[model samples]
Target chain A: MDLRVRELIKKIRTDKNITFLLALVAVGVFVAQIVYYVQKGEVFSLKRGFQALFLSVTLFLLFAVLQRITKTGKPFDKTIVTLLRVMAVVVIVGGVLPSCVEVFVVVIRGGIYTIDIANLDIFVPVLGVMIGIFSEIFSYGNDLQEDNDMIA
Target chain B: MAIIVRLDRMMADRKISLNELAERVGMSNVNLSNLKTGKMKGIRFETLDSICDVLDCQPGDILEHQ
Candidate 1:
């Protein structure tokens, strides 16, 4: 590999750990959000609560898998790329859809109902897409490496 | 993938076993097998050089464009 490509790979390998740590922090924040709602005597619906928990766990596991991919040194493995894509779908379903549902509920109920949107709601799924694209790039890299190895 | 590997034929003509060729070429059996079967995506010049030396054959004798 050239120096620049090697540098990029090194950067990705180092950054995955940070992504995993951020996912862990997200779990804590989600838990805290639930605790805050409870303390305020707010009606935290069971459905939304479950959704939040599921999203939190998915985020954590996605990053965990990414960390493991970097560790395995085979980011282009078809299985891992498929996993990253699957997690992207999970984020859209488990993370983004619930937020959209909350907004939809307020819309259908007319002017009396309201639900606030936090920046985190937008950020998490966007992060998921970014991670998904990163995996795709790695998958392509793997193919290139294979071609280099076999072309002697 | 379009390029073909004739390493197996060359080795066969020399009456060399896969293990013997691999041992002389300093490559593992699996990798050598991959090359022989055209499963390899690429080959290193060093490996090619070693194989050519071991089999007393030119690169053109072992690899050909399809």
Candidate 2:
């Protein structure tokens, strides 16, 4: 058909591939967590394994929705941006909640001095904040794209 | 809010259809429609030139400062 349409399709495919790579990373993190639990001979209980799995799943779902947004060719849609922001908030809160609870429990039980810094708790919060930063960048880009689209 | 495109009136005076003008201007019908309805925030100089050439009118004839 049209040259512009062909270029648009190519761009969408590229975006899909990027999202797929991100999803793959999320899966790798999930699998790595499983391996860590297995190596430690842990029972993989809900408390320990569930948080890792939840974070990875949230990341995967975020990328999936982003891919769909690119496919729909409405990147500047306000509702999509809002959904992305909400998911980022969910990821940030979910990633930090467990660690906050752990710290609270330690303080309550008079074990605050025994807090370990070698745990994975720090990484999750950073990752979640990085996702939040990306979400904000995307939100700004959406506003700019919407303005561009309004130009004749 | 100040700039207005009087394309519809010019097209009426020139007896030219939207489709014919769009083809001559080398732009899509939807884009031309948006421009005509003042929904667009800006217009390119190239498009303005093409439109003026096709309509045999000056830029001021089609654009107005309201």
Candidate 3:
């Protein structure tokens, strides 16, 4: 009930809408990616992998926003942290795997397989998941502080 | 954490029935009873402030750290 803490809580709730929207938009983007590719053959390097990363990161961001909104002051769950790890694996497979394959195909079709990594789509879901995981840990730190205060 | 809520006391002081408070607060009498008995873990600040204002007391008047 400290005045400063109370004020911070109020501010957090007010700002939560933005974070929630960001998360929703990210999820929407991922959904669209899948839908577009499946329906229109508009494939990303690795649609599933990219989405898996994007969804993971945004989900983490959502958790961070929820903590602020709820005034719970901590990451509410560990499962989300685990999700970050899963996302990283998916990202590597999604973006890098495709480019690697393309290079291999080019080499098999002709001379030296050029190290053409410039075409790698790095801004996909995997990177998003990393951001999400970081946010969760940041939110968790707040929770840990609250827990300590309560325990004391 | 044993915060004894004295809602029943305020009701008695004001000579208001539990049913009346429940009706005024737009809550079930049973739910109100649970809140009064500290069976609830959380209460919205809006509800808490409203109840205190109507009962003409501070939250501590209705609830206390036991």
Candidate 4:
């Protein structure tokens, strides 16, 4: 490989390592949050806990995809595509589920439910859709990469 | 799938080892090996040109439609 290409790969590897470490830190934070809630004898908010867990999972999946890229020196792989798609779905569900649970709880308690437009988080699901689009583009790029490889 | 590569036969007739042909053709041994075994999906015109040049043969000598 050219020196520039090797250098770029090395840089990518370093970045991936940093992201992996950050993901580990996020997982640690999630654990710490659980421990704190247990020690306080307080009911853990399911929505908050689920959101934290999903964030950790999404980060871990991102790390996995980066690790695959570092290993193969290519970003367009089937495994990476699948991981990205899963992450997108996780983000979308995680973002929307809290509001859903809130509404469900209020209805169970016999309270009038109204959609709070001001409190609605539209960004997270939008980000998820953006990730889904990126995964699709990567799938196409993967096909081109395979064709290039076959051409020697 | 109907397209076949006969690189091995051409290399044999040309009395050229894979390593030598790969070096002369500016390609890696693994890629050349893949080409020889018909494991590749397709070949580039540039690569085919190099292989033909190195083997002193025509494209038909290395490719067949089965």
lDDT of 4 by residue, A1-152 (tens): 66775777788778878877877776777677667655763333544555677787888888888888777778899999999999999889878886676577667768877887898789988999999999999999999988888887
Ranking by TM-score: 4, 2, 1, 3
**lDDT, residue B21, model 2:** 98
Error of 2 at A49 (Å): 2.1
Clashing pairs in 1: A149-B42, A150-B41, A150-B42, A150-B43, A151-B41, A151-B42, A151-B43, A152-B42, A152-B43
The sequence of per-residue lDDT tens digits that candidate 1 reaches over residues A27-74 is: 666677667656763334423654666566676666666665556655
Q: Write the per-residue lDDT of candidate 2 for residues A1-152, one digit (tens) a residue.
A: 55675677677677667766765775666677667756764433223554655666675666666566656666556666666666767777777775665556556656643556686566666776776777777788888987877765
After best superposition, candidate 2 residue A56: deviation in angstroms?
4.0
Q: Which digits, one per residue and each the tens of the lDDT, describe model 3 over residues A1-152?
A: 55776777777775676666666776667666667656765434234535554554645555564563455533444544554445455554554555554455456657465464686466755575675677467458657754543320
Provide the lowest-lDDT 10-residue window in model 2 chain A: A41-50
- The i-RMS of every model, in angstroms, reads 2.5, 1.1, 9.1, 0.9
Q: Per-residue lDDT of B1-66 in model 2, one digit per residue for the tens?
A: 899999999999999999999999998899899999998999888999999999999999999998
Error of 2 at A81 (Å): 2.0
lDDT of 2 at A6: 61
Could you give the candidate ranking by DockQ, starting with the highest?
A: 4, 2, 1, 3
| Deviation in Å, model 1, residue B28 alpha carbon | 2.2
Candidate 3: stretches off by over 4 Å? A1-92, A103-112, A117-120, A125-127, A130-152, B8-23, B26-34, B39-46, B56-58
Chain B alone: TM-score in each candidate?
Answer: 0.95, 0.97, 0.86, 0.96
Using lDDT as the measure, the top candidate is: 4
lDDT (C-alpha, whole model) for all candidates = 0.72, 0.73, 0.62, 0.82
Which TM-score value belongs to model 4? 0.80
TM-score winner, 1 or 2: 2
